[model samples]
Target: MEEVEVVVAHSERATLRVGEVFLKVDADQSRIDVEVEAMSLAPVPTPKVLWRKPPVLAIAALPGATLGRLGGPSTGSPAAWAAAGAAIRKLHDAPLPPRTGRAGRSIVALAAELDAECEALVANGVLPGDLVTRNRQVAEAALRPWTPVFTHGDLQIAHVFVDAGEVTGIIDWSEAGRGDALYDLATFTLGHEEHLDDVIGGYGTDLDLDLDVIHGWWSLRSLLAVRWLIEHGFDPFAPGCEVDVLRARM
Candidate 1:
């Protein structure tokens, strides 16, 4: 008998794996809708959808292992990271999706949210005031204007699959849509700062991508994520995780 695997479970959604098929159960049908649509539209490789039944979306497992998770060692080679970067650039250059993605927040909205979260973090004693203040300063650069592009808003390393130093697939498109291109780049390189050059190499230098903006996204994402991750029973303070990412900026 094939053993079922509990991939992830939290308040908003849960994912399970049964042999070769992975089933994602989300409370929001709209997110599933976006995932299905974005996969069809994305130019790069994505998981093949097997079926969908309201809350449960079944997809075939991809051929390779993920690049790695946050707070963990990344197994992908320099070539693999670059390949992932190249794929992301292709997605960014694609036509825009109709809806706002996870990374699509306007500067005003994002700044407001960041401010609120920072206050809460300090008030609740979740993080030191100095840490939050410094990161907040670093995050300011990302609040500027940006042209929207197709983005896999939550492009974590673990979501990218690779084999033989090549990108095989990208998964978890629930956050995909029109958004800032730098947001995707920042998300992909968040905890793996050492690999930034490899990704940039694959992504190209002609685009004039700003390193400061990417770093700003890193701080912004870490600050905004700490609360939700805590609520979701995840430890943001884990080594090489969100808190550490912020601490490095200090």
Candidate 2:
């Protein structure tokens, strides 16, 4: 391992080395740095949400190679999905700090938030086809009584890292929140249909995931992706064809 001193302070963003490892540095007083070993696989990039942090100053240790590759999904396969699901279940079972504040009164409030996000997308000249309406209905329905569990908020193949068919760790915890457990299921299913059964099976009845709730989360996530694309100058309509198809079904 090579040790280097910080000449200039950058940001607290995580950096990765392609097919190697990931390094996350904190800008706080301690200047804590975390390094996670990368599994020997990559995931396919689908529409997914990721947390954002400050930038990092890149110091090249190896010649002609970048520090890490930003964006994109892991090489999530059936085994990888199974591993990810297992990891997720373990995380859910772990103790979490108590949640505070009235984030939402009920499903209605959650639905309202989804609606507002969709409306804002449209108002900003981004046409998400029928994703907004579809998501609203799903959100309202999913708000019914269900076991509340910790959610990665953006749980998807992209956010998952795998090596040797085992999930080493999960990345991008910025959107971590408390919500319906099904939300994570939805995210996994929508992006990794082939591994849907495996992921659900891994959940192992610890929590009952309603199909409606999963569908609702799928719609909400799709809309969020489209909105992001629009804002970032990516062709939302073209890249979000799957979301459009789901909207049509709705």
Candidate 3:
């Protein structure tokens, strides 16, 4: 019998690995719908949909290893990172999806939310006030206007898979939709600033990307993530994690 490996388990969702298939159990059907639809629409490589049984969506695992994990050394070379960036560029150039996603949220709403989260991070003594304020200032750069494109809203390193310096697949499409292209850039390169240049080399200069905005998203994401991470049993402050990313700014 194949051992059921728990990939991730949280209140909102859980994923179990059974041999070559990954079974995703999400309470929100809409997210599953989005994942399925986005995979179909995406121009880049995506996991094969094995089947869908209501709360459980089974997908064939990609053959390549993940690009990297947060708070860990990246096994991918600069070429592999560039390939991932190229893939992202292709995804962004694709036609927009019907529904809005994380990157599609209104700037005003996001700003308000960031403010509230910053306050909470300080009040709850999660992060130093100075650290929060500095990053909050940096986060402001990303609040400005941007052209929306199809985006993998959560393009974390772990979501991307690579082999032989080429992108094999990208996963976790529930947060995928039309949104700011830079948000995807920032999210993918979040903690791994060292490879930002290689990624941009493949992504091209057409994005008119402002480094500050990338840094802002870094801060904005970290501040917003601290509470949720703690509550969900994740350690944002772990070395090379969210807190370290924030501290690197100061």
Best by lDDT: 1
Per-residue accuracy of model 3 over 47-108 as CA lDDT, tens digit each: 99999999999999997898788899888898999999899999989998997889989999
Instruction: Choose 2 or 3, whichever is better by TM-score.
Output: 3
TM-score of 2: 0.63
Candidate 3 structure, TM-score to reference: 0.98
Candidate 3 clashes: the total is: 0
Pairs with backbone N, CA or C atoms under 3 Å apart (clashes), candidate 1? none
List residue ranges in candidate 3 displaced over 4 A: none
Worst 10 residues of 2 by lDDT: 33-42
Between prediction 1 and prediction 3, the one with superior lDDT is 1
The global Cα lDDT (0 to 1) of model 2 is 0.50
Which lDDT value does model 1 have at 68? 87
Off by over 4 Å in 1: none
| Candidate 2 C-alpha lDDT tens digits along 54-144 | 3332222221211111132335556656766777776556444244112213566666766787788768656553545656666565567
Clashing pairs in 2: 16-68, 39-163, 42-74, 42-75, 43-73, 43-74, 43-75, 73-158
Report lDDT (Cα) of residue 239, candidate 3: 90
Shift of residue 178 alpha carbon in model 1, Å: 0.8
Query: What's the lDDT for residue 126 in model 3?
Result: 86
Q: Per-prediction TM-score, please? A: 0.99, 0.63, 0.98
What order do you get sorting by TM-score, best first? 1, 3, 2
